[model samples]
Target: MYWTERILSEAETRNSGTESLSEGMRVIIGGATYTFSEGILRQERLCREEQEQTKEAFGFKWKKRDTYESPSVKRAHREWLLKRYFGGESSEIASLLHGRENFLDAGCGSGFSSLLLFGDHLASVRYLGVDISNAVDVAQQRFAEKGLPAEFLQADLTDLPFRGPVFDVIFSEGVLHHTNSTENAVSYLAGLLRRGGMFLFYVYNKKGPVREFVDDYVRDHIRSMSDQEAWDALMPLTRLGAALGRLQVEVNVPEALPFLGIPKGRIDIQRLFYWYVMKAYYRPDWTDEEMNHVNFDWYRPSNCWRQTPEDVTRWCAEVGLRIRKMDVEDAGITVVAEKV
Candidate 1:
């Protein structure tokens, strides 16, 4: 049942320094050990103190819990919605793979990208999807339902479990920044790649004047709010963003942001946070009250952070990674890098 056996096997064959890893197979972090099984890494431990491995300040645990009361289905819904939302970024991901076989989806939430890869690329690509939450169970099930060849593991990316120099491509999107140790996570994931392997990760990116001000204000204020309260507070801003998008008069700025759930925009700065408005501020699909209720649920507590292109580039450089490409999601940074 336990996959630790595989850990020792991989480590004995290929030694690793850390007790764990960021994403590359065979993570060796301080006192942790990760092992690969059926393409996924089985993460069995983290020796950090309870206070350190906590969600006290964030309001929820990084490891999603599954119970009858809150079945994994909810996370499943979020994953489905999030994947479709991120579907636009698929081409960006394709460029990272650049004709590779085996891959590791470090923080693959619900295996959305994995599905996209198999559906579009159909390269007989082997994918290992890992997440810190029990939500991974949902991902596993979804993969099975599709009858695709993939691996799924419920493990923390901070303490990855695959052998090093094992992955040709690593896809970690919008998950690393949520980790308590951002730099460590980046370095850890970096070490997992094979000599020519590539890493694709996405983290929040700082943005426009108005948006940046409000985000800072939220981090200062709503970081402590119950999910509902955070949603309520940000609703007005989302509405204003929506109004801006649907203006009768045309403002031909090179980029602005997407409206509330309004489609189309990768480079357009204006369309950047449309989903944020739909989730944090407002939702055109839902009636005002329903939208607000959903918005409330969306803004709940979790660990979150933003990064700049320069900061992320530095991270790769520190680890001796070669930058190949960079793709910025409205609120995140995703890049492809190869180990030097």
Candidate 2:
């Protein structure tokens, strides 16, 4: 049956009043019965819980124990941005900001990225962050305590509440691919961007058939696991990544393999292993808990989608966006585009 037809049928079934659509009540939709608000609420709760767990595991500083405008806090934010962005080229992200008059941080979790990007320029830029989970609350509190000028809303990416093209820039990193439909989310975000405004985002790359299979196999089994259980289960995989990084072995390829994007040169085994065998690169600064957080991030999400460069380019073209730059790395594909 068509999707709209299925929705109508489900609506008709619900109208029969077999089950009321209450907070915990069940509703049938598209021939599938699911707890109405409860299911969504539970998912939101789980998402928030898992995020907090991972953040704690990753040793993220939640509260600002120091002074509100302490230089230490600023320093910490800078260090985080450098580490998160590959090649420590976070300046490139900042360089994309032509006009900091207004900005939107789509899916801003705990507002850390916003802090790193515009913490100093908060008084000048009208920054707004929207997230689906209760992390918005955490973000709001953080901003409030710091006396930063920013706004946050708890909303879904598929249906952003705002209207018209009012934003100068929209930044969403490691967010769209986690949604139900990355393409739809991109289109929605594009509509919110003013003409000539930039839309910067990162989406998971289609790494290859084998890596795809491994990722799917692991995620399928762990999606339903509890936070602690997922952490425990991923421990071994994280260890393997750590062990590989410790090997410190280097090899030189005789010829360049253009198809696989491998250049003829000396390469570190740990880095190569992370790009091929597994993706659990260990950082000396990260604790064991942080490593588990990395693994959990990989296996806990149910809607992780990997798209190719062609898919990203096509989507941008469909949305009337002109690609500025596209960076492909081991982590994912980062695209900076401007609405045309």
Candidate 3:
């Protein structure tokens, strides 16, 4: 087994089926094991346990959230056409990162997103992908496999050992909310940029039905559930929902419930599947990754609380990060800022 995997296994033993141990966990990567000793859960052994307990918490050792991956992010402008995600206009954002030349790709998971975004943003951009796990190894391997010039480091975002503001641009996607101190994280990132540097981030919004319910489940109990526990927990919901949907009564009359022809009789299997799968892999409009991401988002132990647009604006202002643009997806929020 891989050293990191071994570390996780050992952590599991140490925790003895608990959510996490006070000592935390240690992972072995690149022939040396990097130790993370923050809070109790972040200890060498306990962090590993906490991470295992939380499914969506998978990322490099330092990161507390997953670097989302989906083919949808790479698809052409059909379904995502005119969508506000701005993934299509990545070239523009990449130019911002490229302007920095040597920048921090904060919370860079496997590096594909960075590669996809700022691969050509600059003439030569030294991208530093940071996380807390040997996930750095996976990211580095991806760089080598794809022959992309990039670097990965396993460390916390707060106590970064790097020198002064060497970055002109900072890219953090769908990360930060999972951090223990989200506000502190924002302030810290702002402190790492050059006088005129720019920072681009994607965070979740605090509104919407789908975002609300799912995030609640993750923060409360799912983050620490074992893989089996997550499966067990999600499986029953899907089964029960599917069953309820099956018991729907079919209607054949035109004016069944109203003057207009509206099909409202029993639970629709299509609707149920859509709802059920939004929480796992059996959705009407989703690939395997989307399905898994939803389920993981639900039961994973990481805290995924979203913030309002005003809240983010206030936080960025408080941290001295001036907003350039703001994009809010139902999943969360995205804001591009500059250190003025």
TM-score, every prediction:
0.61, 0.71, 0.65
For 200-241, candidate 3 gives per-residue lDDT tens digits of 887766544553565465446544556546645665555544
Worst 10 residues of 1 by lDDT: 60-69
Note the clash tally of each candidate: 27, 0, 30
RMSD of each: 8.8, 9.2, 10.6
Q: Between prediction 2 and prediction 3, which has the larger TM-score?
A: 2
TM-score of 3: 0.65
| Model 2, runs deviating above 4 Å | 1-100, 252-265
Residue lDDT tens for model 1, 1-340: 1234444444543245655433455544345655554445555563244322222322232222221113233444345434433344645455556677767777665565456443545335666777765446656766787777666665667665555666787777566776776678899888888888877677777655565555555555776565446656767755665464445333344444443323443423224444332224333333344434333322432455667888999989999889876766555676767877
Model 2 poorest ten-residue lDDT run: 38-47
lDDT of 2 at 174: 77
On TM-score, the leading prediction is 2
Model 2 global lDDT (CA atoms, 0 to 1): 0.65
Ranking by lDDT, best first? 2, 1, 3
